[model samples]
Target: MTTEEKVARRKLSLLELAKDLQNVSKACKVMGYSRQQFYEIRRNYQTFGSEGLVDKLPGPRGPHPNRVSEEIETAILEHSLAFPTHGPVRVAQELALRGIQVSSTGVRGVWGRHDLLTRHERLLRLERAMREQKIELTEEQVRHLERFSPEFRERHIEVHHTGELVAVDTFFVGTLKGVGKVYLQSVIDCFSRYAWGRLYTSKLPITAVHVLNNDVLPFFEAHNAKVSTVLSDNGREFCGRKDQHPYELFLQLEEIEHRTTKVRRPQSNGFVERLHRTLLDEHFRIQGRTKWYEALEEMQQDLNDYLVTYNTKRPHQGRNMKGSTPYAVFKKGLPKATKKEPRKTAENTA
Candidate 1:
């Protein structure tokens, strides 16, 4: 029985034994209960009948009033509606800054009670929007998309400091000097966010493989490492040629693992794809030149500088409250590279 039940039973037995004893001190000694407890039990028995011996009435129902109230909950829901991408912990902090105290759990409870879509749901919605543009998605396809989602944190995509996972993709910068338009080959380390890229006149498989094998691989090896895996979207350059794409052949010869995201589902390769957009906006697009090839080498140098700044200086929002840089994290987990000066060349003139 519970402690309260045991106490009640002892109190009841003492009362019965007290009836047979005229001396109060003697009865208290025999029952092993203090005189004050005897008096209290007698008073309770006379006042509320037998039910008074049970535990006190259950406390107020539902969540405590000291916790988030209905008004505060409504405010949180409204705030979430305004900024659907914000997470509960971030919202809680924002509310605290406004002199409104609320726990992350409280905010989550409110959201859960309202059946609101979470941050992952928001990303999934956007992914769905992109998927709709290509073709109708089947249930199995939808499940696979969800499984590979960037927001799904359960599945660990193994990547180490600088060379574990490199995502490569081709993007069009703009019309290049002496060339109508040029395609760019870009590779970024998933861990440190260090990017190595080159511009080419065509999107041919041979050219893509040359960039990966001759330029990219050599650079990585010179830095004293080899990529453990290469992730890419379903692009013609990566998928073997009519017989064997150079990328596939290189992977087989080097014994490097290769993975590709589903066709038309960019979210599977979201990290590098997002980096691509950032580079275009910050470097190429803002250059205001229709033809980029005339200054391709300069652009490449600038891109490398940008990558260094991105890894060593710029703070990542996804990291903790300390605003840590990707390079800081990379250094903590991996061996340091020997410093080397950047090469000076005519094409590299900014």
Candidate 2:
């Protein structure tokens, strides 16, 4: 059956053979055992029943004697729970500074015993600990969780309809030969992913305001919709004194709320980030290699053409898009109570 069972059967057979032959020396020779081994087997079987016949590894048993004390083990676990991203060497060094002398190998051994040898395992332990206890997380711990946890990343701005919330950002399109550097002022509706962008030589507040005033708001107006909130990062172009900053003043004048994302957390404004990626992959990279542009107008014209196709022609497979164009989703997403007859296009207007 099992290795232990096989060994027990062999031992029992040796005893039985010794009885049947009535000769201990002959039985020992036949069973490949010394006379001393035969007596030891018989003594074990007689004393402890069958379990004593099973093989047991010879060791001191339980935790190794040289393992760090419980106090040091608790400190190592607490430090790991606080900063799950730290490696064993760093953990050991930190403990050393605190007068808790523990080698990296010792730290690793403790982690192994506790099933927390990997960074992910430590993070999971921290998350479970937070769920089970009423511990207030520090800012560093919050940032660490957000950095590595996909569930944290998935928590994003909620928008119900088109024009409810919009995201704006500045992107550095490569430098021109004559012009020093080209920057793109990009904006996108958070709900439908309808994007608008304009290239400029600088990323100033005026440039940010100009894109909203000229392209973004006009498109919303044409669709009989109004943007309620504008989300941007804590960049100079978007955030400053409410009375002095051009972007702030523009939002105030238009009666739209200006919301800035958490500092250094770009995923909060993921709509604009995804838009920039699409522009880079589908438009800029392809256009840069195909044509040599001398002026900003040429690049702008090409960008406009691509945008038109992106809004009205390209089938978007984003969340809830259902293979519809961005413009179609933008139109359909408007609340029925707020829906009005959209302004005529150039074809209809003409």
Candidate 3:
């Protein structure tokens, strides 16, 4: 019925024909098989029964000798996970940089076996890895995923603890009739989403420094937490020559690292961007329509009151907030090392 079965029947008939004709040469001629093949088939039947009759393709069985080793394949896969946007040739080159000798063909072979031939398939693999918490997402990976997949735009920046990273931005509130244009210097703790903002007539380097010095640092100081990093866009207010810029000098004085977002990539500083959107939607739009403001001081007062309620009372449903107030998360997320115990003196120990 099957091809193997048919082949086995034909071989069995050859043996019968040889026995009936009483001549091996005549049976081989009628069966269209060489004398050597007939002898080999007969021997296989005697030794392995009908199974040996099934045609096994002539080649090395199992893995090909030319295929990459398991360790190299694993390296390729891990590299792919980290940078899914890289093509086979790029991957090969990257591996080469690491002193791993792998050809572009080898990389393609690995991708093919894993069904990661397309960029989308590779990105989907990355998404799964992120969801499973197997790997931390880098900014570049985040950018790639956000560009390729719309659903991935909901992914939040990963912050482990409070004061780990802080995002700062300058926002234009609106023009005050007598005061010209009003800008807001906004600072937010990326971990807790606790925010601070100040009203200014202009977005200058000093305005950015003033908010951090007067508002952000004091709050962190009260909690015994130190900011290690400040992220901002490449605005003149936030970024300039470290030796000359007021904001840069202030950051240097405070011993905090300043990191600017990539040019033209606003989402690189996404936490601050989201904060600006929230302020616009909840505070500015509502306050603008409902109440008439006479001066910047009046606007600042209302903003301060709103901020108190926002930080202490309003529940946030953000990534790890879990319906907790920013104030609560801020205090709870503080690193244990920050709350240092006083060194025991001889008198105290006694």
Using lDDT, give the best candidate's number. 2
- A best-first ranking of the candidates according to their TM-score comes to 3, 2, 1
Residues 161-199 of candidate 1: C-alpha lDDT, one tens digit per residue: 667788888888766666556678888777766666777
**Over all chains combined, what TM-score does candidate 3 have?**
0.57
Every model's Cα RMSD, please? 21.3, 12.1, 13.4
Residue-level lDDT of model 3, residues 1-350, one tens digit each, is 99878988999999889999999999999999999999999998888898777777787778878999999999999999999999999999999999999999999999999999999999999998878886778999988997878577545678898999999999999998887899999999999999999999999998898898789887887788889899999899988889999888778877789998767878778888888888888899999999988799999999999899889999987777899999999999998855544432235656
Model 3 clash pairs are none
Query: Which candidate's TM-score is highest?
Result: 3
In model 2, where do residues sit more than 4 Å from their true spots? 1-150, 337-350
Mind sharing the TM-score for model 1? 0.49
lDDT of each: 0.72, 0.90, 0.89
Winner by TM-score between candidate 2 and candidate 1: 2
After best superposition, candidate 3 residue 250: deviation in angstroms? 1.0
- Span of ten consecutive residues with least summed lDDT in model 2: 341-350
Assess the local accuracy of residue 292 in candidate 1 as a C-alpha lDDT between 0 and 100.
41
Best-to-worst lDDT order: 2, 3, 1
Error of 2 at 94 (Å): 46
True-structure RMSD for candidate 3: 13.4
